[model samples]
Target: MSVTAVGAFTDEQLELRKTVRALLAKHADPAAVRKAAESERGYDAALWELLCQQVGVAALAIPEEFGGIGATAVETHVVFEELGRTLAPTPMLGSVVLAAQAILASGDTDACERLLPGIAEGTSVAALCWTGAEGSWDTDNVGVTAQGDVLTGSSHFVLDGSYADVLVVAAAVDGVVALFEVDPAQDAVTRRRVPTMDPTRTLAVVEFAGATGRLLTSDGAAALERVREIACVALSAEQVGAAEQALANTVEYSKSRVQFGRPIGSFQALKHRMADLYFLVETARSASYAAVASLAEASESAASDAAVAKVYCSEALQSVTGDSIQLHGGIAITWEHDAQLFFKRAHGSAQLFGQPRAYLTSMKSAAGLTA
Candidate 1:
């Protein structure tokens, strides 16, 4: 199904998409992007400000009462799609969508009041530190232990961990898994950047040695689960945008590059492959929109829909990005080629939130079937 068939985007959302694309076109071009990647922060501060202040992309889904645009999931879908299309480097995924959603879904007004405004205004960067060494989302996999208001243990690969001003961690308190808020600068807190396959996104390992923790909720397992589902949907939307662009670039390159006195794309085999990729892209797009719609309606199948979208997008992106490199041939293997960047992001994003296999299991569990 096409996006229009479902009426997924409001007129306002479409306007937002155009505005964000225009802004990214100006700021996120290849040369400018390479400069940002080499910077210490791994992103452009000025461009991030433009996105948060002028575009209000960070605040789109945040409620106005808490200093945001108070938009819906559909708006988020459009914004995420634009972000992925350009591979725009920003912390919106870690700060606004994932961690902020965890707080909001917990129904903790106090936490939102204290933490959300900074996120909405783009001043504070937050990340959720949930999975540990094992990289499992199951509550039982939580390695951090919270006793009273102090937390102990270590978390690995926390999103935006190296740059996060505030960290929302899932820790067991009183033998119940709960969400705890921590200040990264606390004396007992230790954080270091962990090398990542994709430098566009930062990750860090943080250890708490009896660090002070403020409990967001005594029972936040469900809230984290909900955030995980919605986050996968958001990332899937991004994967679609990125994959779509990769395919477009390949097609353009094929038309211009000649081989054997003919354009490579003119060949039957290459044309057939590109056709398959287009079909994959469209399937992913449909699944992404369906997931967004289900979540927006608060439907019973939201989890299942998100799972399906996440799994399909992950697999599609792998094929799309790999084929992008294959079609580009030798030039693509060079470090400076944009194809390498998309391929790297594809591999990185495939495992974000959870892998396709994990989401497949979630789909089964959601459907009351044995995984």
Candidate 2:
């Protein structure tokens, strides 16, 4: 798809993006972000409330019947982009996007009725436990096993797992994958927050030992695949936003930091590097927009589009953030600089969901191309 076709945002979307950016600017400055990341809950509760209550961000993709805005993935992408721009530590990804979408995709109306409203209002955080210790997020890598209605095993790298009110689990049942809903407060569930390189985000390891679960879907492989595609698209948007912000910050720094009695950005070598970084950011935006548009339309090519976006955006963000650190000089290495955080986020996000090489391999296999 052409960039013009997919990159054009509706007026309402532009306004939504503006409002979110303004809110983050006022409440999620670097200091506040650092504090929130260090908080027990790993996020700014007040800021999250404002985003959900005022902006209805968490409800954007839920159906109207479920107390949501009844919008499409495009709106979710918009919100995620803004969140990524600031590296805001919110559960929107884990609760609102991944787990919430997993539930919706299950075709379990009762589950939706019983659980969605709280998620829509951002009062209840949901964690999707799927990946194993390897963190591949693949169907074969599912960590949990279900015996009848009881779940056992451990899921690693679960976003917000430690404090989530609800758990949406993917487990193997009779050699088939299924989705289950379990209360995190259950006696059989144990969640431990894990240390990660990216302080701006939190992950947990959740272990279940015969925890009784409400089955959401017996045939969950299809739903899990769909959720992964949607997640890839959503995450591509985040990567694009973060890359743009990282490049912007680096450019701004280059304009002020002087060397040889002139701004470093005035140097031809640095100028070329910044220009190249700008290209990566723009191209990543195009790829993300294309994937979002395809997903919004339910296009047949959506899966491939998501894979492409995931690969391209992940690399772009890594490149931009790495260059950002270099452009900012030694100051970027210090804790006082936001460049370090962005760099860490870039590397962390690249590994989230799945790595770029994994996606590339999948894409090749999908095309029946022998490596």
Q: Judged by lDDT, which candidate is best?
A: 2
**Least well predicted 10-residue stretch by lDDT in candidate 2:** 1-10
What C-alpha lDDT does candidate 2 achieve relative to the native structure? 0.91
lDDT of 2 by residue, 165-237 (tens): 9999999998899999998999999999999999988999999999999999998889899899999999998
Model 1 misplaced stretches (Cα beyond 4 Å): 1-8, 365-371
Q: Given candidate 2, what's the lDDT at residue 330?
A: 88
Cα lDDT for residue 181, candidate 2: 95
How much is the lDDT of residue 195 in candidate 1? 74
* Tens-place lDDT digits, model 1, residues 1-371: 11442555667778888999999999999888778877777778899899899988888778999999888888888888988888877888888888899889878899899899999989888988888888776755676998899899998878877788999989987677899889999989988877778767777788999999888887778888889888988998999999999999999999999999999999999999999999999999998988888888788888888888888998898899999999999999899799988888999988887678876776678679994
User: Which pairs of residues collide in candidate 1?
Assistant: none
With candidate 2 superimposed using the best TM-score fit, by how many Å does residue 151's alpha carbon deviate from the native?
1.2
